[model samples]
Every structure is written in C-alpha cells, then in structure tokens.
Target: MKRASVAVIPAAGFGTRFLPATKAVPKELLPILHRPAIEFIFDDIVGAQIPESVLITSENKSALAMHFSEAPNLESHLQSNGSEHLLEQHQNLLSNTTIKYAIQDRQLGLGHAVLQAEQLVGDRPFAVLLPDDILLGGSSFLTKMLAVSAQLKGSVLALKRVPPDMISRYGVVSASQIAANQYRIHGIVEKPSIHDAPSDLAVIGRYILPPTIFHILRSTPSGALGEIQLTDGIAKLIESEPVFGLIVEGDHYDVGTPQGMLACALTLGLEHAEMREHLLEIFRKWSQK
Candidate 1:
C-alpha cells in the first residue's frame, strides 16, 4: 500500500484552555511527563514511517519548530535531576525525518490552519494529527488508517464510540456499518446537543484527507466563531466524496485541558512500579487529611 507522504500537524491555535501556563509557551510545546506533548504525535508519525511532517504554526510559536531540532548548549540541570527521561523540554531531539514549517499568518480556525499547507502538501493525500490526541503504547492506528484510505480511495477519520454524555463534546457522525469496527460516514455534526446527536461514533483527532478537501475547505462556511472550522469542511466534503471512519480501540487521550493532561501523565507514570508506589503513598497521605 502507498503511504501518505506528508503528515500535517495543526499547531496554530491559541491553547486558551491551558491559559497562564500557556501564556508564554505554545500549548503544543507544553510538557507532559517531561516531554513536549507534540512529540508524542511525532512518535506516531515516525512509527508509521512517514518521512515528512509539516507543522502549521504562528510566528510567535517558533519554539514548536525548534523542539524537533538540536538543542546545543542546553543545561543538564535545567530540570530537576532524575527526571530528564520524563521531563525533557530541550533534549533528545527527533532524527531521520524532514521537519518542515508552514506559517499561518492569522489565527483562524482549524480548517484555515490546515489550508496553510496546500503549497507544501501539493496534490497528494496527507495525514493530519492533532497534537492533543496522545496515543499510548505506540499504536498502529495511523498505519491502518492510511491502508484503509488507500484501499477505499477516500478520506478516513479516527472514530471511537463515546458515552452518551460525552458525545456532545465531539463531532458525532451518523454512519452505516460497512464492516467490523468500520463505518461509511453519512454526515457529521459538530459539538451537537446531546438529544440532537446522531450517533455516539465520535471523530477524534486523526484524519487521512485527500487533496480535494482543500477545495472544499475554501468554499466551506465559517461556523461557531468567525473561524472556518475543519469539522464544517469535513461535513461539506462528505457530500461530494466518500468519507469513512475507523473505530479506534487504542489508548487515546485528549490532553487539551489541564485535567486531561494530568490524567494522561498519571496513567503513563502509574504503569511503572516506582511511580505507582510513589503515587499510592501520596494518595494514602491525602486521604488521611
């Protein structure tokens, strides 16, 4: 199967959910377990053997680009001792991949941010990985999605059956089951009301979009805020092209908020016996108070 040549990561948004902490740092650069959260996304891209990554960034977010590059003269004592493996900010740079940067001059919506990569992506199909969706255990979701896209010759979205209460938080899709854990998307409703939601199958972060999406995104309308939302564009793309969803049963965390970030970190840490015992002691002490 042919692999998507370019993997696009939209890192241009102002991470308002992590304000104050994110006031100085780009949300994409926010540290999780000592490593930049965005690196986890790159881990998947590299795992899938995609050679190129294009980060859609703003002018002020130069640090996002630098994270993949060398960190010469970095201090060893920058972070606390015994935590370098978990808390790397300026160390263990990425290698053997082409890291390209595309500047989004304006802070528009996700669709507009993705639009900045048209020149870099050209006429080829591409994968989009939102930095917030950290997949644990080195998943093969991206590879599988690429394979599905190649076979179907259409766009593919990462789908997961969310609880009814949480269904309203995501772009819920009404789909017909074409195969086990796979569905042909009929339509998408962005952050719909609980009662109005079509189905629980939620479009998480990963996307395999064909080049035709660029044209659809341009003519797509602005929604919610005055920004051109990517969800809206995807909804429009559905009318013209075949869109499918793959229900991912992998460890996926939405770390856009502080609470979600903490949850993801704790989950990863507790997997190790030392950190687990340490956290257990802390929880025991807190319970006694």
Candidate 2:
C-alpha cells in the first residue's frame, strides 16, 4: 500500500450558500474566530506532518493564492512594530508545508475540482480535505484515516453517525462492521431520501483516496445537480477495490452554512482561554427556563 504523501484540498466552489460574504471572499477564507476556516484545514494537514498540499481552486480566487504566499513588505512592517507573531504563525506553516495550487477554471463540482489536482498529485495516494468541514481536534483525523487506508490497502471515508433526519444532506453508506469503529463499505448512495438511506453513517469531508480515483472521476458523469459527484465516483470505486469507512472520535462540523459556522465559532470560542468565561456567561443568560 502506498502511503499518502500529499493532501488535496478542493476550495473552488462559488459557496453560493454563504452568498454576498463569499462574493468578496472565498468561503474557505472566512474567519473562524480569528483564523480563516482554511487555516484550520492546513493546521490539521501540517500537524500530521504532511509535506505537501495541492489546493484545487479557481483562478478567480486569487486571494486563496495570496493568503498562502509570503508578503515580504508585511513581514518587514510587523518586525519593526514588534507584532511579528502575527506573521510568525503563518511563516511557520509556510516553512513546514509546501502548498501548490491547481486551477479549476469553472465551478463544476467537488469531483471536477478534485480532478484538477491530477497533474500535481500524479499517481500517488492523497488525502482530500474540505475546508468547509471543520474537523476540530486537529490532524488526528487524517492520521487515523491514513492508518486505516494503509491497513485496508484502499480508500477510506470518514464516517459519523449523524441524525437520521439529516441523512439526506450527506452521502450515506451501506457497510458491514469489520472491526471496532471500522466498516467495510459495500455500497454508498448520494443524498438519498430518508426512506432510501441504507444507514445513518454519513460520509464526512475527510477522505483518503487512491490515484485511480482520478480516472473514475473523469468518467463518473454528472448527477442530478448537472455536476460530477465525488460520492458517485467513490461508489463506483467500491466495485473493483476495497473501500472502508472509519469513525474516528472527534468534533466534526460542516461550517459551510451560517448556523453551522456560528455554532462552530461559539463552541470554539468557549474553549479559548480568553473567551471561555465571557462566552459561558452569555450562554447562561441566553438559556431559557
């Protein structure tokens, strides 16, 4: 089994969900407290000690490119003002991680966006991380998935037990429990209605995919959304190879929606030393009798 050496982050969507705010800024760049949501993605990747990342984004999103690249002018100013820590945080990340961008000219879909990284990723195994999905507790998610992928010698999907009512929001899987917290996924359905869902195990944003996925995606065809669905590709992959679902213990949230984002922010805010007491007091007063 080839160990994944790079992470592929697809950040090219129009983020129609976030609207006007995303009109000016990419959803991935939206602030999660003080840090951009994409920073959280990078934090986990770097934390896992991954050496490279292929960021699949649109050419229109130049901000995404600029955010990762260094600014010598800004660094000089911060140094003179003794506020170097601001730049230092990102500087450390840049030093440890090499980020390469793959241009997805059109906002086709997640599968199409991911396909843009084929040249950069070549034939090696790579992890797919969605910036919109905030996997708190850090790189442990990636580490666990990578380990699972290695053992299975196949693709691994991060699985979570979401409420049954919300099953349609994700690609649900049909799997047999092979071991503790691990399942051998025999089938997967994309956004199936509650009546059709096989199980409550929702496939989350984290994925450890093999390069063969690129070819599958190319011929995956468009779904009802008139776009290539990554879920469909993975489902097809199951026919020829091993695909597993791993349920790792961690706080995972789809912060792409306003409510989800706010909930994540508030939860994270309460965990920070400076905001914990203040946020707790507010929540206490807001609670109903």
Candidate 3:
C-alpha cells in the first residue's frame, strides 16, 4: 500500500521569543507579507499535492485553526463593500484542502510534538513542516524532499549547509555520501559546537518520515535538555534503516527571531511586483537616515 496522503505540522511551541505580541496571538498567525506564516507552509503542502494535513498545536495556538476557518462576518463585510474579490481569496484558502488538528498538550520537544499526530497519521509515511522556518525557493522544498523519499523508499530530511559559526544553533548531521546532493546519514548532533560538529550540513525543519519514527521517538530517552530531541530519534532511525538527506535549494529564514522575521518580510515584500517600487523608495529613504 502506498502511504502518501498525510502531512503533519507541529505548531505547539510557545513563541517566547516574540513574547507580548505572541502572548495572545499565536506566532504562526503572524504575518509574513499579508498572509500568516503558517499559511505559507500550507500553501507549500498544497502545492506538493498532499491531500490532507494535521496540525499539532496547543490550546494557546487555537488561533491557527480559527484563522483557517470561514469568517462569515468578515466575508459579509468585505462583500457589502466593493471588496468581494478579497473575500474570494480568503474563502479559497480555507476551501482548497482538508486540515485536521491534534493537541500536543505539552512542550516536550520537536520529536515529542510530532508523536502527538501518530493517531492522525496512522501507519503511513507523513511530511513534517516547521512553520517558523520559511523555505524560500521554487519547486516547493517539501515536494523535493518527498520525491527523494519516493525514490529511496526511506526517510528523508531537508538539509542545508549552514555557516560553521551557526552550527551550534541547529541540528547538525554526520552523513556519508550516497549520490549527488544526497547522503546516507550516520548520526545527528543536536546543536553541536562548530569545532565538534560532525558536518556543516544542518537539518532544516522539513522532514519526510516513515510511521516507524514514532516507535523510536517513544523509546529514545530524553537527553540533558530534559526534552526529546527529534535529531536523536532520527539518529536511532539511521541505525536500523536508511535515512537520507537532500540539500535544500533555497534561502532559509528563521522567522522565530525578530531580526529574521524582519529580513523575511522585507525580502518577500521587495519581491512583490505590486509593492516593489514603493518598497524600494522606502528603502532608499531609510538608507539616507
């Protein structure tokens, strides 16, 4: 049986980084351009032709579901004016695909968060996306990772070469070459120092994982951080079955941080043909200050 119907998204993290702003509003609902950050992730999944998605979120993040729901009042207000077209865009966003929600309840870690959706995913392979990390490139990153999984018949992760200095901020992988732009991962280090890093390649937030990962996640003991790290489970998975890494062809932005979020918004805003001239003029004025 082919197992490719589900995509799992873990959005349960408390955005302590953004504090007061995220206190009431879920960080995932924060705007990148005009659309919320999570919406971009959903768009990418839809572009990949994934039929369904399960978002694992905590009670605090309920706004995510609300954002995706039909806003009848808002739609009516928009239509009553001459803004019916805007309503159509929003309605299409909600109606384009099916989405389910699962509660993580606790903030254990990324691995534990993903395990929350085991029931929703059942015994099939699923895609995992971290909305905080916006992958900016054509040929949707998830689609590219899924294609590699389809060919190799194993778990695959979106990997990117990070600066050596930044290695400590990401989950670094030690891999053996398998083919061009592909690797058979031997182990993964969780935020290792630059000197101690196994390799410069860091595992980005996207993953195409098999259902078997749940077992590893359950059995793997929590590390020093008192949380179950996803990289640890992936390392264990490597021991038993093949785990490959595909070098993502894109600029990755860590929108979880304020600076990163500003950069992402500015970069994407400048790329918009409609907003390009105005944005450029503002940039030029700001540079003179």
What digit string (tens of lDDT, one per residue) describes model 1 on residues 1-289? 2358889999987899998878879998887766679888887787778888899999888877666666444435534354455434234325535889999988778889999999999888899999988878746689889888888878999998889889877989999999988899999998898899998889989999988889988998776576888888999889988999998866879999888899888997888777889888899999999
Candidate 1 displacement at residue 167 in angstroms: 2.5
| Candidate 3 residue pairs in backbone clash | none
Clashes of each: 4, 0, 0
Model 2: CA > 4 A from native:
284-289
The true-versus-predicted C-alpha distance at residue 280 of model 3, in Å, is: 1.5
User: Could you arrange the candidates by lDDT from highest to lowest?
Assistant: 2, 3, 1
Residue 190 displacement in candidate 1 (angstroms): 1.2
- What's the CA error at residue 244 for candidate 1, in Å? 0.9
Q: Write the per-residue lDDT of candidate 3 for residues 1-289, one digit (tens) a residue.
A: 2446788988998888998899999888888888788887887788788888999999877788888877778878987897988656556656766899999888988999999999989898888989888888787878878888888888898888998779999999999888999998888999999889999999988988888899999998997777888888998988888889999887889898989998999889889999889999998999999
TM-scores of all predicted structures: 0.90, 0.95, 0.95
Model 1 clash number: 4
* TM-score of candidate 1 versus the correct structure, residues matched by position: 0.90
For residue 192, what is the lDDT in candidate 3?
A: 96
Q: Assess candidate 3 and give its TM-score to the true structure.
A: 0.95
Model 1, 215: alpha-carbon shift in Å? 0.9
